[model samples]
Structure formats: C-alpha cells, structure tokens
Target: MSLSAASRPELDDTLAIRRRTLTLGLLTLTYFFSYMDRQILAILVELIKADLKLSDTQMGMLGGLAFALFYAILGIPVARLADRANRRNIIAVSLALWSVMTALCGLAQNFVQLLLARIGVGVGEAGSSPPSHSIIADLYPVEKRASAMAIYSLGVVLGGGFGTMIGGWLASQYGWRVAIIAIGVPGILLAVLVRLFVVEPKRGLSDAARVADSSRMPSIWSAFADMWRNAAARHLVLAVTLTSMIGYATSYWGPSYLQRSLGFSVGQVALIVAPIAAIIGTVSGVGGGRVADWAAKRWGIHAQSWMVGLLKCAALPFTILFFTTDVPAVAITAYVFNMLFANSYLGPTFAMLQGLAPLRTRAMWAAITLLVINLVGLGLGPTMIGVLSDALTPLVGKEESLRWALVVAVSATPWAIFHYWRAGVMLKRQQEMAA
Candidate 1:
C-alpha cells in the first residue's frame, strides 16, 4: 500500500500571514480573558476571606485544588477532542462555559458553593490552551512559532494584570461580587466573536512536504507512554511543573502579602504593584519569545531549553531577596526582577514542547504536560504555601509567617533550574541523534 502524493503534507500557504496575525490576535484576546477569569480570584482573596470567615488553608484550596482538580483531569479528554474535532468550536464553547462559571462565582453564598464555581471555571479553561497551541503550530512554521506563541502568551500577563486591577477596583468600589461578574461576562461575547471570525487550519499545513502520514490519531495511553520513554520530555515536564508551582504560588499570594506585610492597601496593590509586575511580565514574555526564536536560528532546537534554564537560574537570587526583604521599595524592586525572569520561559518552553511532540499527538502532549503542571503547580502550590503559612503563624505571627512561606515557594526554583538544565542537555543529544 503506497501512500498517495495527495496524502503527503504540502505547505498550505493558503492562510496569509495577515490572517495568521489576526488569528493570533483573536486567540490571544481569548487567552487573555480565560486567564483573567481564572485569576481574578487572587485579587479578591482578602475580600472573600473576610466575608466567608475562611482560613488561608481554605483559601488555598479554592485557589489550587478545587479549581485545578477538575481542570487537570478534564484537560486530557478535552485535548483529545481538540485533536480530532473542530478546535475553534472547542475553544468557543470553553470560553462561554468558563465565563458563565466565573459570573456564577459572584453568586456563591458559602465556601463550598464558591469552590464548586471555581471548579467549573477550571473545567471550562481546560478546553482553551491545547487547541490554541495546536492552531498556533498550524499557523506558523518552527522558526516563527515561539514569537507567535509568545504573543499569545501575553494573555497571561494582560489577564493577570487586568484581573487584579479590575477585580480589585470593582471590589473596592462595588464589592468582590461585582468585580467577578464584571470580568466574567465579557468573555461570552468574545466566544461569539471566536466562533464567527476564527477559521480552522488543516493539520500539518505549515510543516514541510513529505511528512509521514499518521492517518489515525494516537490513544491517550500512547501519548503518556511516549512522554515516559523520552528523557527530554520527562525532564521538560518536571521543569515546567516546578516553575509553575513557584509562579502560581507567588501570583496567588502576592496581593495579600503586600497588603498585610508591606502595609499596602488593596488599591495600592492593584494600582502600583500589579501594574509594575504586569509591565515586567509583558516585556519579558514577548522578549523571551523573540530571543528564543533568535537563539534557535543561531544555535539549534536545544537553544530554547538553555534560554529557559539560564533565565530560571538568574531569577532565583531575586526571588529569595524579594521574600526576605522588609523595605518596601527594595522588596518591590526585587519582585520586579523576579517577575522579569520568572515568565520568560513560557514562550520558549511551550515552543519546545510543540516542536518535540509528534504532530498527531501535539495537542494531547500539551494536555498531558499541562495536567502535570496544573496538578503540581496550581493543585499544590497555593495549598502548600497556605498550609506552611498557617503552621508558622503561631511562632512567627501572620506577616512573618507569610513571608517565610513565600520563601519556601521560592526555594523550589533551584530544583526547577536543574531540570531545565537536564532537559536542555537531553534536547541537544536528541537533536544530535536526529541530525
């Protein structure tokens, strides 16, 4: 049975670069809204705590386990669907679902109700990234992918910043309820836009001609098996998970830490700290992608891993200093440096993930990677820090307890750096073997 020429992948330059750019912009806006809905809770943490009479541990559960559990679990199936189904539709439905769930969060009268609502948000968001990643891969070639994906990745910064700002301002002005509702409802409109405007691309359209024809989609178990067998993939998964743990913990707690420990009000945290961190995050996220693309051009496939590893290593000292310092200005400056380096990996790391994966299994590989990341990072990061904070409260009091707990989170960066280094080395070897 000879494969037909028509079955072989031909570069479909049918999607113009401008269309690709527009698609990226639209998807990035979708991602931005997705993250904003998810993270708005961070800025509203204190208000929720006060109203619900909740402990930090409980708050942590809402932030991490409650949301991440369903999110991580459902991502596999959703990504599986994305592999075969219409990705744009999956993303549109997901946007609407999460937006509605986010609005419902405002209506919850108790912790359990709120927890369920957050869980709903998680389930909705699970449908977003995998398909989005797959689409981006189809839209751009390997050389230009990191930068394109980096633009999409700005959703993280924009959403986080806007979530904090809008959530905080709404909470301050009307209440947290209003804030949640305000942020959540707009996404439903965006979902409609997605359905109307976004055109789906043919799989493998952007790749070079003569690709192996994978007529059948791989099973989920096979995806897991592939990752387990590949040393570079395994290490990359662990590396991102560790870094995400640190990143999630910091972003989730930073608002409370600043308010309680540094004597900043919610307004101040929203207006000053959030904006500063957002700016740094935006710059680093975009710059990292461009730098990664450049590195790949100059070096090789392994260049991205090295870039991520070096950034992680460089960010460590600043992270520790941010946690240890008492001076407001110095602490904020340190935090700025941490933010700058902390997010730089997202563009390159994801680019590497997309590149390393088998084309047929790309979305599932992303889902599997995210499952580990969210389970360990979002699932445990906040909860662990909150538990640690509660444990140290009697001895050190609230402020110092939170400070040290953050330090504990930051301590994990070194472990993340090690894995990144290993992934880089393995990637180089893997590339060598291919060559």
Candidate 2:
C-alpha cells in the first residue's frame, strides 16, 4: 500500500494543502507552548537570581546544562519510541509531561528545587521534535517540506515572544512563580487537542521508494553508523548544532543584555524588544523557508543548503556589530537583521536532515540531530557565555562583561557558516548523483 504520486494528490491540490496546513498548525502550537515552558526562565533571570541568591554560573546551569543533560540523553530513546509507536501519542504525552513539570517550577522553594524542575521539563520535552519532523516529511513532498517546517518552526518565535511578554508582565505583578505557572497551564489543554485531532500520518506517505527498503529498520547504532557514513548528514548536524549554540545563547541572554547593557528594565525589555524580536523571527522564519524552496528549484540540487550557509556567513558581521553598540535602537536594529538570517536555518536544516535520512530512521536521526543540538548548543552555549561573563566581571564590571562575552559567543557563527558550506557541497553531490 505504498502511496505514489498517482494515489497521493499533488501538494498544490486543495485537499492535500488543507490537511498539510492543519497538521502543521497543531504541531506548531504544541511547539509554541513547549518553548514557552522552556524559555520563560530567560525573562525571569534577574528575579530568580535575586530570590535564589544564585550566581550567573548557577543560573546558566539551570537554564542550560542541567536541563540539556536529561533532554539530550533521553531524546534518543524517546525517538526510538517515536519510530516504532504512535508519533501523535508521543507528542501528546510529552506535552502533558513538560507542562506539568513547568507548572511544578512555580512551586520550587529553592535554587535546587527549580533546577530539578527544569530538568523534569527538559526530560519531558525530549519527545517532541523527532516525531513531528517525521510526520511533516510524510505529509508534504520534498519540494514543499521546507516551507511546511518553516511554518511549524514559528513556534520558536511565537513561544519566545509570548513567553517573554507574558513572563515579564507576570513577574512584575504576580512574581516569577505565578509567571511560570500561568504559561504551563494552557499546554495541558493543547496536549488534549493534539491527541484528539492531530492525525498520525502514515509513515513515508510522500516517498514510498525510500520506505520500501525494510532493511533500513536497523538498531539505533546502525542508524548512527549510517549518519556517520553520510558526509552531508555529518556536516549538516555540526553546522546546525554550532549555529544552535549561538542561537540559544543569544535567545537566553538577549533580555539580560538589553537590561544590563542597554539600561532597560525587565518589563521594558520584554514589552519592547521581545515583541519586536518575535515579529522579526516570525517573518524571517517563514521567509527563510520560502527562500530555501525557491533556491532549490531555481538554482540546482542542494541549493537550499547553499542558501542557508551563505545566509549565515552574511549575518556574522552584523552580529558582531550588534554587541559593539551601546544604543538600544542601534542594537535592536542590528539584532533584527542578525535574527533574519539566524532564524532561517532551522526549517531548511530540519527538512534537509529528514530528506537525507532513510524513511524509517527519520525520527531517530531527527532525535540524534536534536540530541547534539541540546547537548552542545543548549548545554554549553549559555554556560560558556555565563562563565565568560563571570570571569570578566572583575575586569570590565558586570554589564560590560556581559557585552564582551556575547561578542565572543557570536564568533561561533563563522564556524557554523563553514560547516553549512561543507554540508551544501556534500548535499549537492548526493542529489546530483541521485538524479
């Protein structure tokens, strides 16, 4: 019962487009709340620092490594479950698990308690992306997949935006505890919506030739070997992970920087910068996906990959320039451009990874991609910046030290650009041969 083009309607057809839209919307909504629970801590950083009497390094650990450890470690196993069982069910359960953990964050009495709660949130969140990626790949053909994923990736923007705005408002009036609790509550209802409505797309619906190779259902180790053997996959993973490191660091610390360096209060930063960043993120995210799709068709094989690499290289200068500025207007302006290129990478990267992987192992590879992303990006990126900020605090004072640390963190962008370029070349070679 393989679905070929004859049996499966064309992507542009009305029915197919509607179903794809519905599926992407639901999954994106789940991702939105997921990020809300995960990233709310960024807006609440100073408050938590004061309440817990914690250092920057400790806060970084809570935000980065502590949560990432469980998230990266558990992600592989959960992805395995996603590969074998119901992906929609996995999404539903994960949503509920993380939402509850997020709510528990409100009840934390001490730093350790809050750290533990964040870990629970990470563990719960581990189940999310892989299956969703797998589902999107199934629903959309290769030509349209990147755009669909881009729309889905809007969760990051919307979640981060709403999370910052609402988190700041709540922290101002109700306290950080209530802020944490309020955001976590809506997710329980979203989880139920996913369970009730989001259909579990039959695996490999768009590409049956790849799926017919039943031997692809090997052990997780076998998939790891497969990935290692894939030069494009290897480069793509490294590129995406390196970029994510910078993205995560910027995302978690951007509010802090605006407050400390630019002299905005938490409320001011959230109200002004957060919404602006979100709007930029939303536009750039969808625009990036469309650009990738257009590049692939207009340029040649793997042109989408090249587009991503080029965009990253192009953005590095602006990122460095952003940190050097003292004026809020100049910095915010620079950040908009930086994020325009920066945010574009995820949708294309996810689509590329899923397209390159064997059909059955799509979810597992997605998990592995995220594992590295969470482990290296989420784990080290913030912590490194935090540690650097602390070490330089005595030399430059607190605010200036933060600015310097972010400058150094932005240096990683060049490395990401290099990997993306290499991935583009490798992906081009593979696609050319396949054709």
Estimate the Cα RMSD of every predicted model relative to the unseen true structure: 2.9, 3.2
Give lDDT per model, in order: 0.88, 0.87
Extract clashing residue pairs from model 2: none
Which 10 consecutive positions of candidate 1 have the poorest summed lDDT? 8-17
Model 1 off-target regions past 4 Å? 1-13, 16-18, 209-212
Instruction: List, residue by residue over 1-435, the lDDT tens digit for candidate 1.
Output: 345555433333454344788889889999999889978988888899999999999999999889889999999999999989899899999999999999999999999999989999999999999999998987889999999888899998889998998889889999999999999999999999999888788776677752635688888999999988999889889999999998889889988888778888888888888898779999999999999999989988788888898988878888888778788999899988888887888778888888878888788988999999999999999989889999999999987888889988888788998998899899999889978
- Per-residue lDDT over 268-354 for candidate 2, one digit per residue giving the tens place of the 0 to 100 score: 977888888899899989999999988877875378778888888778877888888988788888888887877888899999888
What is the alpha-carbon RMSD of candidate 1 to the true structure? Answer: 2.9
**Residue pairs with backbone atoms closer than 3 Å in model 1 (clashes):** none
Off by over 4 Å in 2: 1-18
